[model samples]
Target: MKTKFFSLLVACLIVTSVFSQANLNDYKYVIVPTKYDFLKESNQYQLNALTQFLFNKYGFETLMEGDEYPEDLVRNRCLALRSNVTKDAGLFKTKLLITLKGCNDQVVFTSQLGESREKEYNKAYTEAIRNAFKSFEAVNYKYEPKAKDVMVATENTEVKNEVAKEIKKLKEEIQALKEEKKAEVIEVEETVVEVVKKAPVVKVQTKEVKNTKEKVDMKASTSVLYAQEIENGFQLVDSSPKVIYKIKKTSMKDVFLVISKNGTLSKKGSDWILEYYENDVLKQEVLNIKF
Candidate 1:
């Protein structure tokens, strides 16, 4: 009888331990902000990037705050967990904690306190953050979204209803506009035909000129870049994934240039090179790019 009782006690304790350790797999994704509350600027000392890198290493899909939301998250924002790094001040030690919060702003899990005695801010913060992440390293992360969280489901339902109403209204408005446009087209058909015939030669020249100007403007506007993959070009961003430069591929093999921008970066026989106009003079620099 005592042996049976001991076995039962051990089973209960095992179950309790499993439940107490928050399973990160319950969350679909982790969102890391560009800046922590303790920092003034985005990616200051590259802490934000470090946080994102660690989360990604631990098998969690991460998204920056400025990034476009994935379809699943767009449909339900509560699907992802927001990551926060909080700092604890000590007289001779720097301490930090990594926390995950749900959409309702409730903290689901927090890492054990990480401490460092380094005098430098950057080194201390980096070491402390690394220590805190040790807690996450022990867990095997596998995505298992909590579909039955009642509060999250209710909030999502309310948002879905509102979006549905807005979409219906927009569709009705668009249908009305189409009908109005059709009537206008009929009224202007005869006039348009007469004008086309009279100004065919002049219109051809004007179109060529307009097309040239449009090409120039498009090239100029492409200078602004973001880390997000675009349809026709590539972008370079900082640790915060803020766009610093935009590059467009050229006809030459493995060569890319800044579209209408004052800089050009190209691969040159085992080395990457960058040339740009700065201070009304051309400047060149060697770049070390990882693929």
Candidate 2:
């Protein structure tokens, strides 16, 4: 019975040890700092780099403080464990231990103390750090993000709800502003229409007269002419705003003449022709006119 009880106790202890190691494996990543508080310089003695390399070798993704981190780790730094290396000095030997802590600064795992008898600072520190990693080699590390506590989860949900409420309020305010702008545009358009309705109308009369001396009948029509009032007389345009002719008043009442850079137009047997001086020579072009 004593032998059986001893065996049972040993088995239970083995199971507990295995459970603790498996729990530690749940962490997805480890963050190593470029410099430790006790170190004089960043990556001094290459200890930080060595620590990162060992963490990576042990199947835990590792990043230095200056290295770009994964999005999940960036969002929730609690997702990864922080690695710390400590040195223990003796008269004849150097001792080292590596520790992993959570965001709460609580130590999660610590390696057994490793000692080296080398006299040089670089070699002794390197040997001691390598010896310390032996404890890490025994456990299998696979990334499994730790679950948040109930309280933390509830707090996060509340924060998300508040953010959602704020976004909704902003959207509503934008919609209200858009509606107000639309109403203002409609009001301005209505005011312009009212002003146009109240504007004064100008009347132009057309007369058909016979010129027996010239053996021609001249008819004046406004349908083919689009005139814009200018300072002198008017500018004649077609369907578009491009000025086809510039009409200026003459000494004769109600009579106008065409002025253009290309030429001046005169009536010849009911057809108009443009005459201009070009290259010290007179040039003439027949003009097609409705009036």
| Candidate with maximal lDDT | 1
TM-scores, all models, native as reference: 0.46, 0.50
- Which runs of model 2 end up more than 4 angstroms from their true locations? 1-16, 146-291
Residue 216 deviation, candidate 2, in Å?
A: 23
Model 1 per-residue lDDT tens digits across residues 210-255: 7644221111122322344565457776556576667765444665
Give Cα-based local distance difference scores for all models.
0.73, 0.71
For candidate 2, give the lDDT of residue 174: 100
Write one digit per residue (lDDT tens) for candidate 2, span 1-291: 999999999999677667657767767788899997777999998989998998888888898887888756676787788888888768998999899898888887888898999998899988998899988766766665445644555777799999999999999999999999999977866764464334221110011112222212233433354668786566777766577778654443443445674334456677555454444344445555544
Worst 10 residues of 1 by lDDT: 215-224
Off by over 4 Å in 1: 1-17, 20-23, 146-291
Best by TM-score: 2
